[model samples]
Target: MPGFSKILIANRGEIACRIQRTAQALGYRTVAVFSDADADALHVHMADEAVHIGPAPVQQSYLNIPAIIDAARRTGADAIHPGYGFLSENPGFALACQHAGITFIGPSPEAIELMGSKRLSKIAMIAAGVPCILGYQGAEQDDVTLTREAERIGYPLMIKASAGGGGRGMRLVHTASDLLAQIRTARSEALHGFGSDELILEQALIDPRHVEVQLFGDQHGNLIYLGERDCSIQRRHQKVIEEAPCPVMTVELRQAMGEAALKAGRAVNYVGAGTVEFLLDARGQFYFLEMNTRLQVEHPVTELITGLDLVAWQLAVAEGQPLPLRQEQVQLNGHAMEVRLYAEDPARDFLPQTGRITAWEPATQSGVRIDHGLIEGQSISPFYDPLLGKLIAHGATREEARRKLLRAVQDSVLLGVQSNQRVLANLLDHPQFISGEFSTGFIPRNFADHSCLRPQVPSDAELAIAAALFYQASAQVHPASLAGWRNNASVPLHYRLGLEDQAWSVELNAMPGEVYRIQIASRSLELKIIECDGHWATLVIDGVRTRHAYRLEAGQLCLFTRPGSLRLTDRTQALVSSQVSISSGTLKAPMDGAIVDVLVSEGSVVSKGQLLVVLEAMKMEHPLKSGIDGVLKRLQVRVGDQVKNRQILLEVE
Candidate 1:
């Protein structure tokens, strides 16, 4: 029955759900493994069977290979698909699956092992005559060796973790003076994130395009390239947007890049689905980046344009079938675009956000697809990656694809938590992006003045509508009286609304025939309610009519408007402190995470912007700095201590 009658997904969240969709569609029983924190996760409920692996921490659950193998044995699943993250590139996991007489549905363990290390892989690619970035992959990892290598590579080099991906353990050093310090920092991050302190250095290519070729190989010695994807738009070395059929790709260039990718794949004798990534410079010369030996997060873009289900291909290959098509027979179709919907605040250093999702409405229309694991009332935890889903669109041309994707992103909804939706929309609508003239430096270059990406306060008209909604919801207590009615037309009822740390006070008074006057701090605006439904409202503010998807509950209001998702807290009657921070001297945990280092001791004199503590959350390190020049008066956290959001980690005076 195509290698195995049952398949167990050794992952969680959207990827697991995505894999299950293809597996079940092919008539294979699917099993899901979840950590303690994911008992009620969407993937668990979607599977034919579910198994609890371990605690909430990844080390105990998702990365617990033995536990996963045990689950497969108990569930009698004959195959396992390590979807992207957790154990996707882990050679040990693949070896374990092989020893358990299970099909790993990926490359050979030797291939995974070789390609997993940036050091080894670079050496192999160079040996195979592939163009590669000039770098240091030497095994000598001492500070002195790294310092010497950094000098040889010159300034503006990149220090990267040899053992992992996802921008973790990566640092871009613009000067030789900062090389040694950055090496130490990258090493520490590498050790914590990937269980290895080894590193690799490379000449950082400034403003180059990030492009990758998708490759598939079967056990019968057949291999084919599935075109390429442009992933140049990135933030913090992590991809934000991706599109298939690189905008500037010509037939000759595609052939050259495709053949080089094939050469890289053949060096490892790679099998199953894999992607060979490269950094293409403005001059048209490309250098090998790395090879990802699994289905990528943005595979949907390739699939959308090619009209082939990659998971189905993996299954067939694992069953010992040849590649579905040869390289010459491969056909490229229309343009396709994709963007990650991350639970991150773009305006706040792209920090990971956590909370419950109160609403879930993905875009549903022609040529659009959403791969997600969200449900209303689901809580977004800090224990995993912040990606909530992906929005993908395909059309006849690049512009058609871009327009469709922009609408899909704006129409999609993920409430009760911060998302990068606004930034995604802004990026899609960007002139540089529309012209296809951007690179990996797109985000930093455009967002250097980050205020443009900052969350705009709800406009006066939006606030007016919000005030009306709040009045209507609260008036349930005074159902007999018309909402917003006042004894004197000159006076009105007071209200305070807050968005994050920004708050404003306003007043509302009833006028004639469904009209009201909203007096803001500096100006007054007229409002008229056209209609109101369960979760929909139509209103006109200052003669501009608009419709909004809104929700008001227990003094908390959520609305979807042109400004993105706005959740405002009604603070008029609440006796809570309006300050987002207790004081400048207080160093609080930004989110639930484990303390990696306590940089300052009690009584230590600290200056403003001095790094005090390092916290690791969602697989990334965030350094908390002193906000004021003072002596550390209290140090409440130690290394490895698990802390909650907003919990005071230290105090100074």
Candidate 2:
């Protein structure tokens, strides 16, 4: 049979680039679709042909089925590949592709509709003899009915959106008092995210391990399971780290779970790639969680261990092919691990960060692979998922893979935006992770120290080197007889710098031939510049040599080293202090987002730590609370207002 000659990827970011790479290797032309915000994005340039879809927001672009199909038709593409997130699992998109006579590179629309609803999928799982958690999946969604169902299921249950994944529209309620509010929030989020307000309830298992089995099927009814992946390392109910071949899995358990996963697949005549998730408890028993009907974000680890290209398999199956390998022929070798690098601050509750990437350097090694969609000057907007890319490492043993990944992360460089690099490094070194004895509570129970997330302060020697570099750069511009030679020779030239809410004062005396004697907080050191460039500098401090990547942007000095990156402001010329506090009664937006709802009104008395507003950014809802007990004196924002960073939204007095 003839395969597809041209394929169009209907997604953005790293996943889009990933699919194009495979399609190009298979001798197929590739087409890319992008929003206005992503006009110059990396994926757009990597494709054989590019088309503009719509504006920045997803509803106007990626989620617009008509725009995507029109782009494919204009480019003369014969197939469409929905790479994960946006409309990958939407049955409507699949059915529309079929109507347009375009081959959808995934399972049939029937399978998507059957497994898209968590409530319906659970019912099907039960019929297929798969174990499921005790819960309610009724149709009545009124407040009173949900409240009564919560009481029947008892406290500490889960409310999950029936139509979406990625932890969106999901909440854990610990008591009856908070049930109604949570249900409303979950329903609103579900409607906004998935266009469906339907939900299902499940018993919240304590500290359960998240394991999922990978399955693939073909048009000829050949289906097979490809082991499992452990995805329990999470924060805010989203996976942070993942690995293939669960650490605690034995041959017996693997076989049983594999069979159960196959049963679920066969139940829907599942075709293409899919994952069956389960919640593994302490007693070694597993219960069905949900099924993902598209390619997963962590598919790299599975591919690394199994020596297979999942995207290639996806394309072949879309062309009416049979399974390339039987169950007995499938083999799992070596170990692979992956970490998701996000554009967010790990120190301040992982708040999403938006800025321009000044520098981008990815790790390159034999066993390491970097899948990213970033340019040197790309802007990370708060309009989509915060995932920048993923880093994967493979080795013969799990320990080897862990060590290799640590080294790779250290060698990589990503400046300008705050990332989870430090947090990921610390987690890999933690005792629990190293020993492979941890649960879902690992982050909250063991890794609560926010100090690890903060950037380390420069040492006295490093400070002297920075002073020398700054003075040298200044002297070259003025061409003075002697750098910083003042009428009053006894006092040295003083400079001030600010770094992450802290200020430092430096006193420096310039010497001959680009040298300086500097003092910071009673510590003195001598420094000499070995080589000087505006972007990078090499210096010798008290006979110790070091080099650092540097950038000066808008009076802010950024230094990048192997340990980490730090940003400092030149505070010498400021008339007032740079660190200005918000007015006593003002509440400012933490980041750029749309105000979802305001929980309090003016003149209402609220206690400390009361939820005042809910802001939606980067596709997640964050609640802002009152820091002090006070009356809501003024409301500056409404339910549907768009806000910027540090924009005042309300006031309390």
lDDT of 2 by residue, 349-397 (tens): 8899888888888879879999999998889987899999999999999
The residue-by-residue lDDT of candidate 1 on 1-653, one tens digit each, is 25689999999999999999999999999999999889999999999999999999999999999999999999999999999989999999999999999999889999999999999999999999889999999999998888898889987899999997999899999998888888888988899889999999999999999999999999988888999999999988899999999999989999999999999999999899999999999999999999999999999999988999999999899889888787777788999999999988877787898888887888898999999998888888889999999999999999999999999998886678888888889899999999999899998888777553677678887788888888777666575674337344566888898887888898999776667899887889999888977477888888888888776777888898743689988888877674745348988888888998888899999998899999888878889998889999999999989999889999989
Clashing pairs in 1: none
| lDDT, residue 320, candidate 1 | 90
Model 1 TM-score? 0.96
Runs of candidate 2 exceeding 4 Å displacement: 454-465, 481-491, 561-563, 599-608, 628-636, 651-653
- Give the C-alpha miss distance for residue 515 in model 2, angstroms: 3.8
Count clashes in each candidate, considering only residues at least 3 apart in sequence or on different chains. Answer: 0, 0
lDDT scores for all predictions? Answer: 0.90, 0.87
Range of the 10 consecutive residues with the lowest summed lDDT in candidate 1? 482-491
